[model samples]
Target chain A: MSPKVSQEHMEQRRAEILKAAEKVFIEYGYERATMKHIMDAANVSRGGLYQYFSNKEAMFETILEEGLSLELDETLEMLKENATSYWDMLMKTIFGEGGEPDDEMDPLAPAKLEFFIIGRNDEHRRAYGKTRYNNGLSIYAHIIEDGQRSGEFSKKFDHEIIARSIIAFIDGLAVEDAMLSREDLRIKEQSVLFVEYLKMALGISEHSTDGK
Target chain B: MSPKVSQEHMEQRRAEILKAAEKVFIEYGYERATMKHIMDAANVSRGGLYQYFSNKEAMFETILEEGLSLELDETLEMLKENATSYWDMLMKTIFGEGGEPDDEMDPLAPAKLEFFIIGRNDEHRRAYGKTRYNNGLSIYAHIIEDGQRSGEFSKKFDHEIIARSIIAFIDGLAVEDAMLSREDLRIKEQSVLFVEYLKMALGISEHSTDGK
Candidate 1:
């Protein structure tokens, strides 16, 4: 009984460390971010941090696993809830909260891109990256396939293709965000625009506010 | 004079070095690629190569400037030719030679992505990356604006937004290409499908071969 309680506490502590480490990685980027910075950000001693993660890479992999999979699970759950139209659900799954523009981009985007791009030359990292990317692609494709079955989306294009395009657009924006200043890229506006493009491709009626 | 002949020969030698360096970079990637690999690939002595480029980064920057901007300039010239429809011209500008599906992906994509993603933490690199990205965006936007003025494309959405979407989709594919194997992502097919999506968004007629 004591061991079980301690295990639960460790998991909670691990989550806290990941949360803080993500912020530090975002601010400083992956190459510049250090284990010391993570320890400082998490407000944990080196011993405490190392107890959960072996190194910065281990901490990053943990963060990515949690962040990427959690979002996928949440989006899938939203699809299952059936609270809105399929199109609305798709948009919500993508943009969150009625698909409105946000003031800032996802803070983790830079680190995420860094991980995958730098991982290209590494066999282990490349394999892991492929899994995460395919998982991401499947989530969006699954939503579109579901929408098609429900007659909410057009059958003009393959659902898989459209889903891939969505990934491409989102990934492209993240790439731009990594290299360019926020003002130069207009990430939010570009997202809304891509959503509009999705509507056209899916044969859905355009929203009045779209493209304005 | 012999000096004139020597200068022309030197220009030819520099071009040869860059071509070989590009091939080496493609195979090993930017981080893993060594100066020795370039020296071997180019068949130039270390002293001979150093005369042209001070370092690997310098070699890469020269390659990028020539490769990226030269393509941009060529596309812009194609747009000016007026021999093709605006949509066809735009497609050619993007995918080359009428947007046909090719057997292979862009060879330089991995290195280009590495340069920019790794640049996120470096001020000098980050600045150059932004300029290139924005320059790429504006080229697309300029073509779209021109098309709209000629009534070839409906001004349904802001041209700049569509332009950004184009960047996102292309960039996104590069990101996916960097991480996932070619078979899994189907980069060529995705590009073709995306062109179909752009057709719908732009209110153009669908081609029979589209979205296959």
Candidate 2:
């Protein structure tokens, strides 16, 4: 029989399971990673696993939320606390150049993409696109508008357009990282090089952020 | 009963079906736009549809090929047509934003993105990204390496990194266009805005290609 752990112990167990789950997902890709593997990795019984989470997706969702939340909080906090212009800190975050690297990614992205691509059928991709388009964009749009109103940025180009472009840029970066490519793109210098290109692209300097 | 038509007429009918398929995919989103819907819009028998294409995915692939082949061909042609600075025209062709407008876009982009994102999980997204990355970027990398050799752009940065970033930037633009709140983003002005931002990022003369 599975051990009858207390509630506190169960919560700790769930965290441990999720921690293992993240490693499996990263190594195997979401579709290929099996429940048996997760169970073995987590060192939990079948019934025990069910008690803590409903399914693989629920487990992933929790990990995704907690992981991305931590990463986003750290990235945004770095940007906000630095008191540098949005452009500089944004590029730095992308490069993982400065401050502590809180997991060099937003965890929800690959899973969100895999959901659109792998899960469901034809009816799903379109619906997912609509939702992805809506939810993925609004927060950034609000952020851009705030930057503009506060005079931290300019209103020369369409704020929505800039926001969407930046969203796409970040998305593309995540895709780069997700690839099982022949080239070793994960090294620190390579990553920083890419981020510097983005910095120049956004005109992130005190010289150019003057509404240039 | 199916109506008989000349070979030329049948070919024209096939073209019409693919065109309608594009609209159908975009209109209903990729997943929900069924073969039945596409048949109704394209005025093709289900048998005829199957004859031209095996499934919704096949039809989507054909539509993408029809739309984007010209742009890709043009990029390759421009690369070899002259001994001019390949990097300069490279920006113009992909991101610099000069093209004969069709419907509401530069024709190649909106549909390319639509089909790619629709097939984000299919062999198509992988194929599309691979073909574009391998062929287009392999060519651009050559030019950047040449520039590095000639000591124009910085030799301090990896030519491969810059080439990939530029490709990612262009891909990111297409993805942004593919997924955006329509109210916030206007398709007509997208190419122009993209070019402007690209020029700023690259720190090039505002009118480099104007006299050419």
Candidate 3:
């Protein structure tokens, strides 16, 4: 193969392996998952897996980075477009296209929780987690700040604190999802209530769609 | 010794062992902590530690139950007395005696997170977690319900959902605390913001002290 074609093929193979690794991590959780399992699932030889990733932690980190980076990019793009109202923008950022909560949760949530919680004491993992958290925080803070600046939201509360609370609520739900049954989580109800909170804190009426 | 005295001695020893186990769990975290560590910390014989609790899970459960039950009882007693306003009672229940957020966090918080996250799939542990969650939920819900009934809080939102959000915020902070430095967690700031949310959702003014 030409050098250019070879480069493209290598990238495709790496993506394929990551897809398979994600399934194994989700199924068995981070602590229990093994690279051998990823190799089998990806239909790659042991050497092939090792050539792409050194360890499970490296694989998991890459998966998390890719997913979060995609989300961050999408949110930044939405903000630049300014096609949606601030409230709707915030909702879409949190709950995806419909901007509503349902019974569904990220399937990889438990594995992600395990990865961070289990490795919390490790300096490298903790540093990475902090960076990921700040990145997530910035997305929400940007929405709130824009809303405040545009007179769409009140300046009654610190935009960053409000943003941080949003992260807390979502992270808290992830923790609850791990421990409780889906029915018991009341994810939809809590989310609806949280929206009410954001509206009240932002001093925006529920009916307001000024920027829509 | 008399039979009654012997029984008291046994109870005292059990409490001492739990105290030592709590220390061990806090120092090493749940996944790494062992019965042997507890025995060494408590300065007890293998048989002595085993006599009161069958395993590490049982000991940890007892520690959690004891702490929560005590908090629950205190909250219930405060409610019966009607010695404080609804807002103060709620704040006190969440933040303890001063009804304000501070830098301190429960020493056992990380260990508790580890226990539940690691054993999330275990039938027995999951059941215990659900029960514990409900118990914690009732405390906040009760405060909100009483406030609404007494005309101190707004009936605009369901008290149960408000209560659940409070738990989510607190649990989310705990998760953040594990992965980030204390400064990064911004525990006090996030907590103060949450209090603002509770105020808005309940429709109570910051100055209100109707029952105080």
lDDT of 3 by residue, A1-212 (tens): 89999999999999999999999988888888998899999999999999999999999999998998887787667656754778888988888766777767898998888888778888899888888888888878998999999998999988998998898888899999989988888899999888878888898885685443
DockQ of 2: 0.20
After superposing all C-alphas onto the true structure, candidate 1 shows an RMSD in angstroms of: 3.6
**Model 3 in CAPRI terms: which quality?**
medium
Please identify model 3 stretches exceeding 4 Å from their true place: A1-6, A210-212, B1-5, B80-82, B210-212
A64: Cα error in model 2, Å: 3.3
Predicted model with the maximum TM-score: 3
Candidate 3 or 2, higher DockQ: 3
Give the backbone clash total of model 1: 0
- Once model 2 is optimally superposed onto the true structure by TM-score, how far is the C-alpha of residue A198 displaced, in angstroms? 5.4
The 10-residue segment of model 1 chain B with minimum total lDDT is B203-212
- TM-score of chain A considered alone, across all candidate predictions: 0.86, 0.70, 0.92
Which regions of candidate 2 are displaced past 4 Å? Answer: A1-5, A20-61, A73-92, A97-108, A116-166, A176-212, B1-6, B28-37, B73-88, B95-128, B138-160, B183-203, B207-212
DockQ for every model comes to 0.69, 0.20, 0.79
Across B3-74, the per-residue lDDT of candidate 1 in tens digits comes to 999999999999999999999989987877889999999999999989999999889999999998788677
- Candidate 1 deviant stretches above 4 angstroms: A1-9, A43-48, A76-82, A101-103, A206-212, B76-82, B101-103, B206-212
Residue clash pairs of candidate 2: A122-B31
TM-score of 3: 0.92
Residue A15 lDDT in candidate 1: 85
